[model samples]
Target: MGEIAGGIATAGVAVWLIALSACDIRSRRLPNTLTLPGAAVILVVAAGTGHGLAAVAGAAALFGVYLTVHLIAPAALGAGDVKLALGLGALTGVYGADVWVLAALGASLTTGVLALCRRLRGVRSTVPHGPSMCLAAGLVVGLSATV
Candidate 1:
């Protein structure tokens, strides 16, 4: 029963991520409607699964890190990316710290690749970041299942 519930919650998170990523790609912004409620749902589900406090802490920490980066280099990161990271952190913490680390690594690698591609094409680099987030989320979820 617990496993089944976890599976359902994970599926919901994936769907939510897909939708949020698409919206962010189109608008260059992640609406609060998507991020806030998604984070709330993850928190509630994590609490029910006995991982609430850790998940919340992880989310807060990730948010703080992103916020600091945004403040230091406003042109480098967007507000939507920070909010999305918070949600991803909550999901990862609920699953495990390993998943969180994997997600972060994945996002970083993807961003680097995109920047390189932009440079190769002689285009000004401005990644949407949503696709990378979705990629990271998917990788983390898949790795969590296997591990």
Candidate 2:
């Protein structure tokens, strides 16, 4: 029963990430319509699972970090990515600090790789990092659900 529930949760997160990825890739935007509600849902789930404090802490940590970067380099990181991180952080935080760290690392690495790839192709524009963030958090949650 636990495995079944885990699988369903993983699938749901994956779907949400995929939808966000598509939007970001298309318009370089992570709409509030998705990011805000997604964060609320994950936070509620964390609360129900007895990880409310951890989730809030994770969200704040991630949000603060991203917000700092956005403030320092608005062209390098978008407000949408920071907003997206709130939910992603909570989603990973429900598992533990380790998972949250891994998600953050994964997202950073993914974004770096994408930027490198674009630079190599002579496309100097900034890469929208929302997809990488979504991918990282989804992978973290899905992997945790399996274990």
Q: Write the per-residue lDDT of candidate 1 for residues 21-102, one digit (tens) a residue.
A: 7997788888888888888888887788688987897798778877898899988888888887778888877767778778
lDDT of 2: 0.89
Per-residue error for 142 in candidate 2, Å, reads 1.8
Tens-digit lDDT track of model 2 for 1-147: 377876776677778899999999999999999998999988988888788999999999999999999999998899999999899888888778999999999999999998999999999888889999988887887778669
Candidate 1: 10-residue stretch with minimal lDDT? 1-10
TM-score of each: 0.90, 0.92
lDDT values, one for every candidate: 0.81, 0.89
| Residue 62 displacement (Å), model 1 | 0.9
Instruction: Please state the error at residue 141 of candidate 1 in Å.
Output: 2.3
